[model samples]
Structures are given as structure tokens and as C-alpha cells.
Target: MSGRAADRWAETRAPSLAEIEALADAAFAALPEEFRTLCAGVRIHVDDFPDEETLTEMGCESEFDLLGLFRGVGLAQSGEVVSGQMPNAVWLYRRPLLDYWAEHDETLGHLVTHVLVHEIGHHFGLSDDDMAGIEAAADDITPSEA
Candidate 1:
């Protein structure tokens, strides 16, 4: 294929980072207020792929191995904020999410929300069952029909 055609093909196949971030934001907004309050101080970020340091820390052999990651103290363990301490953050890796989306029938927004909730759920010290229930409840209220 010609270079121009190849570039166009790549652009058409991949979701932009801005698109992913918007989806994540919408998904997060759909969550229950109780859950959102729990995630008040959390920051969500999106990247095309996981960095090398992240892969090593997560014990993954490849960047695509991790779709999302939660870093920082859980609500149950975090005491009063100490000086210079970093706040909690949840990272959503776009490349892995796109890979998963390509293989599954689910919408990208839903997938992003799911990963975001799962990670933030950890911050709240919620169990897997609790997170699942929260996800279901959130899905029921999602306005976009995605």
C-alpha cells in the first residue's frame, strides 16, 4: 500500500486519545453519586499505551497486557494527607482498550467506564461483587444507550 493509504488506514482503525478520554468522562459521570463521591480525589488519565516502568511494576511482559491500573493508597488505608504525598490516580491504557474493543462487541465508552470503575472501586475498598453491582446499576442509568 502507498504511504498515504497506509496512514489513512491507520487513522481510520484507531480511536483518538481525545475520543477515549471523552468516553471515560461520560462513563464516570454515569456512575452513582455515592460511588463518585468515593472517587472525589482520584485522577483519571488516558495514554496510547502503558509505559515501560508501568509494565515492569505491573509484572507484564507487554504494554497490551494491562488495560488499566490503579495507583495509590486505598480509602481504607489512606490517612490524612501528608505533605508531598501523591494523590490516587487511575490510568486507562488506550491501546489495550482498543485491542479489547476490536475483539468484543461492547462499545468503547462502556469498556472505558468499566475499567475506570474497577480501578476506582479498589480505591474505595469495594469487593469484586460490589464493583460488579455498581457497574450494573450504572449501566442501567447510562443516558447514551452505548
Candidate 2:
């Protein structure tokens, strides 16, 4: 509703990686302060699709099988950062997420936020209560497609 008229969709294109990253940033920023604090130094990365290595690692037969992923030690495990160690990261697969958005009624922002929270929650070893809070925060931030 914010962009051009509906008749102009054919001239438009899918969201670029930069646009997706922006959406992720907005979604992340909308999270609760406490949750955001826990994710300090965590980087969010976006790619059109998961690489072959990632697909195999995730045991996915198709590229679209995974929407997002969290890679790194959970907060409940290790606290100290070792030299040259990779920082905690969340990967959002753009193409798959787009495909999913097309099939469902959820807004792109909401889906992205959902995937983000799931990954971050996994990183922090969040409890059910924490996850519920995350979901609520996401809902508050994302506008409904409906």
C-alpha cells in the first residue's frame, strides 16, 4: 500500500538482498530491549539461497526446505569468546522466505521476524516463556498482510 499502485506489479522486482537486510534490521530493532541485549555482537546475514554446504549440513533435499538458521554456540554453553572465533550469526534464506511468503498470508516482515526470533532464541537457549515474549514483540512490530 505504500508503494505504487497495484497495476504496476509486473514492472516491479523481488526485494534485493539489501532490502531484505533492511527488513531484518527493522525486525531486530523492534524486539524487546532485553532480548536485543542478549544478542549483542550477533550478525544477521542474508543470501538468495542456502549454499550446497549449508543444504547438506541441514540435510535438506531442496533449497527451499530451510527458511533461516542459527549457527554458533548457544549462550547456555560457552560464554567466553576465543580468538579468531566466528561470532554468533543468523542466516536468512531470501528466496525460500519469499517463496513461503507467496504461499501464505503472512507479511514478509512478519515471516522474517518469526524466523529471526526462532534463530536468536535458539542461540540464547530461550525458555518457552521467552519465546512467547519474542513472538508477541514480533507481532507488535509487523503489520498484518490481511
Candidate 3:
């Protein structure tokens, strides 16, 4: 047998929201082109945590309760925009995401995609079943097997 000893290493840097955002962007880009086209105008944001006000408004007892949020008019309500309307926005809570990461074995990109798709499901006024099917289909394409 060889005399070589095993080696160990550690991550020298801590992960930040920006890092997660970059990963999320790549994951989103890797999504089926048709899906990307449909979400072309939507904005995705990453923050360490939601503000106290947002938590209250969202009826969450703790910040970690919310992993992601969709804060804009759905497709059904988009036509109501008269003028000076803001574009759709989606917020991904990084702290919560990290908390989830600690408990799950999946990669960050996959988690972000799951949250993104779920939020987009809301944007399209899709029912729970509809969203489930959409997520299942996305999984078929991407295969969370990673």
C-alpha cells in the first residue's frame, strides 16, 4: 500500500448573498430557454433577511419562516397597471436559505431554482396543483439529482 496520508481542507471564505445571487443567476440561466423567455422581465433579488415590516406583513413569526417572496402583480393583475407602474420583483431571503441549506443536502442553486419557480407560480396565479406540476416538470428537465 502507498504511504500517502489523507488530506483535509476547509473553506477559507464565508458565503454571502451576492455569492448566492450569482449562483442563482446561473441556475436560472440554465433553466429551459422557454422558461427564461417567459421570466425575461422579472427581477430577482437576494437579501440576508426580510425586514421586520415585511415579516409582519407576510404574517411570519420569524425571518427563517420565509425562504422567498413574490412582491408584484400576477399575470391576472398585470393589465391593471395604468402608468408609472413598477416591474415585478421577487425577493429571496438568504439567511433563511442558509438555514435551509444547513438542514438539507441539496446545492444552493437547486434550492434557489425551487424558490424561484414557486414564486413565479404565484405570479401566474397558478393553483397549488398547477405549481406542483410545473415544479415536477422543471425537476424532470433539471433533475435535482445533483
Candidate 4:
């Protein structure tokens, strides 16, 4: 490899959990205002990989099989908020997302935004087509734009 290329590679490190969380937060902020308004109590979390229990529940043979997930009641199921409701949560699997990002031409920020929007779409009780549209909208938002 070229000398400068090697030097740059040496300085590169995987994003830490905090960095990934920051990316998610930025991505969320970049969503259209109306969409953000609807996601009142949704939470976003980042982990290196899925836990064993999550793997078992999802029937995943490998941790890399999943990149992100949404866990909670969608808007369609809600009649009214109860006192004991668990806040809706979206999980981003960092390692798997990194793996996927490496294999594709998409930027890391765009991938993160796509995954975040997808999970939020689920929370909004949107269909696959609806989520795809949302992801398309989010993809247009680059890191600089965000």
C-alpha cells in the first residue's frame, strides 16, 4: 500500500459505543420535524452485538445476522398511555452495522440513519413500503447536512 494510505489506516479505529450513540442521535435530529414529533418516548441504544437472549428470541444463528431492532408497542396498538408502559426502544448493533457498511458503498452515517429511521417507522406502525420511503428521505441527509 502507499505510505499515506498505510498511515491513515494505522490511525483508524472502530467507533466506540458513545460515538455510535452520537451518530444515532444526530440521525434522529435530521429526520423531518413532523416525524420527530411523533416519536415522543422512543429510545435508541447501541450495542456491539445482540445479546444471547435476543439471538434466541430472534432465532439468529449468528450475532451478525441482525443489525438493528425495534422493541415496543407500535402506534396502531395504542389506545391510551398507561402508567406502567415500557418506553419503546430501538437497538442498533454496531458490529453488524459496521460489517454491512464495509461490504456496501453507503456511508456509515447514512447507514446509521437508515437503520434508525427504519426502527422508528416500526414504532409509528408503518409498513415496509412506508419505512422504505422514510429511509429514502433520511439517506439524502449526509453527515454534513445532519
Top-scoring candidate (lDDT): 2
Model 1 segments more than 4 A misplaced = 1-13, 144-146
TM-scores, in order shown?
0.86, 0.88, 0.79, 0.88
Instruction: Give the root-mean-square deviation of each candidate in angstroms.
Output: 4.9, 2.9, 3.9, 2.3
Enumerate residue pairs that collide in model 2: none
In model 2, which runs have C-alpha deviations exceeding 4 angstroms? 1-5, 142-146
lDDT of 4 by residue, 1-146 (tens): 99998998799898888998999998888787788889888889999999999999999999999889998888878725677887788999999999999999987888898889887887777888987777666666644522
**RMSD in Å for candidate 4, one decimal?**
2.3
Residue pairs with backbone atoms closer than 3 Å in model 4 (clashes) = none
Error in Å for residue 113 of model 2: 0.3
lDDT of each residue in 1-146, candidate 2, tens digit only? 53566647757688899989998998998898888998999999999999999999989999999999988877877756888889889999999999999999878888888889988888888887888788797688665542
Residue 19 of model 3, lDDT score? 86
Q: What is the per-residue lDDT of model 1 for residues 7-42, given as tens digits with 9 covering 90 to 100?
A: 876867466888888888888988999888868788
**Alpha-carbon runs more than 4 Å astray in model 4:** 1-5, 144-146
Residues forming the 10-long window of minimal summed lDDT in candidate 1: 74-83
